[model samples]
Target: MEGYLDIIIRCVSVYFFMLIALRIFGKQELSQLNTADVILILLISNSVQNAMVGTDSSLVGGLIAAFILFLINYIIKKWLMKSTFFGSLIEQKPEILIRNGRSDFKMLSKLGINSDELSEAMREHGVEHIKDVKLAMMEIDGNISIVTTDQNQFKETHYKRKHNHKNLQGEN
Candidate 1:
């Protein structure tokens, strides 16, 4: 029982460390993983395994750690739904990238979004020209949602981005 308690504490620490690291580094879409990113994740898991298990490499120890991780994740998800403050701390807010057919250059620069990517996203939404976009926003989930007009018909399209945008500072 004492060994299991140690395992639980270690796993809980690793889980929260990972959560904070991901939030700080800007969470990217899992589908957009590159070779290096995949390797990094694998290496990270390997390195953290020993830390969580310490000297106890028994099957029971591993299971206890896994259970602790799952339990903590479940609690966090429930809290996120019920608590706005908790959700805000863990999630990035959506930002307007383009408004009234004009690109917010400061917002773009801060987000490290280049013009070509913006253009591509716009085209994906069927907006041939940037000037025609009524609104474009970077959603919290690392997706670009473009709103456009075609022959008086409002159209909105959303697609996942490979990279997450950094928060823009001062004058959004």
Candidate 2:
């Protein structure tokens, strides 16, 4: 019983540590994982496995740790959904990159997004020029959302592109 409690405590501590570390380091990578991100995640899991289960190599010990992690994760997610402050701490707010055909240069630079990246995103959304974009936002989940006007009908439409825009500076 004592051993199981120790395992649960260790697992919970490791889970929270990783959660805070990812939040500080940037959650953007989770939304769009590259090769390095994949490698890093694999390494992190391998490295933390021992910390979570300690020296207890028993299958039951490992299962207990895994169960605790899942429970804590579910609880945190539910709490985040209910608490606005906690949600903001763990998640990022969407940022406006372009508005009314004018690019938000300040926000673009702050987010470490280059013009080329933005252009590529626009192209993916069938927008040939920045001037054609009515609005462009870097969403919290690391996606670029582009709103454009249909030239023929003069109506607004939204398009999504998978991309990462780092950091944030309020809305435009």
Candidate 3:
């Protein structure tokens, strides 16, 4: 019983740590999973597994860890819904990438967005020029939402990543 209690504590601690880390680091990179991003996710999961379950490789240990994670997630969602202040702390506000057809160069640079990547997102939504964009925002979930004066608002989440592999097409 004591051992199980320890596992619970560890799982809960890790959950909160992850939430804070994501809040500080940003999450727009989540939807845009390139090869490297996929690899990083895999590695992180593996690394955290031990921290959650410790040396207990038993089935019950695994189930307990998973259950705690799910419970924490559910409770957090409910809490966030009831408290705007809590949600605001955990989630970042949407970042303005462009306004009035002028790109926010500082925000773009701060968010690690290059003009090419921004342009790619814009073109997908039928925006041919930055001057045509009424507003472009990087949403919390890592999707770029573009608004044009004449067109309906739309959002896309394609991450532009360059890879050098024989089987993959080269970057344009």
Off-target runs (Cα >4 Å) in candidate 1 are 29-31, 151-157, 164-172
Candidate 1 per-residue lDDT, tens place, 43-136, comes to 9999999889899999899988888989999999999999999999987778889997899999888777888778777766778888788889
Q: Among these predicted structures, which one has the highest TM-score?
A: 1
Better of 1 and 2 by lDDT: 1
Candidate lDDT values, in order: 0.78, 0.77, 0.78
Instruction: Evaluate model 1: give its lDDT.
Output: 0.78
Task: Output the lDDT of residue 5, model 2.
Answer: 93
Q: lDDT of candidate 3?
A: 0.78
Ranking of predictions according to TM-score: 1, 3, 2
**lDDT (Cα, 0-100) at 87 in candidate 2:** 91
Whole-structure CA lDDT of model 2: 0.77
Model 3 regions lying over 4 Å from their true place = 151-172
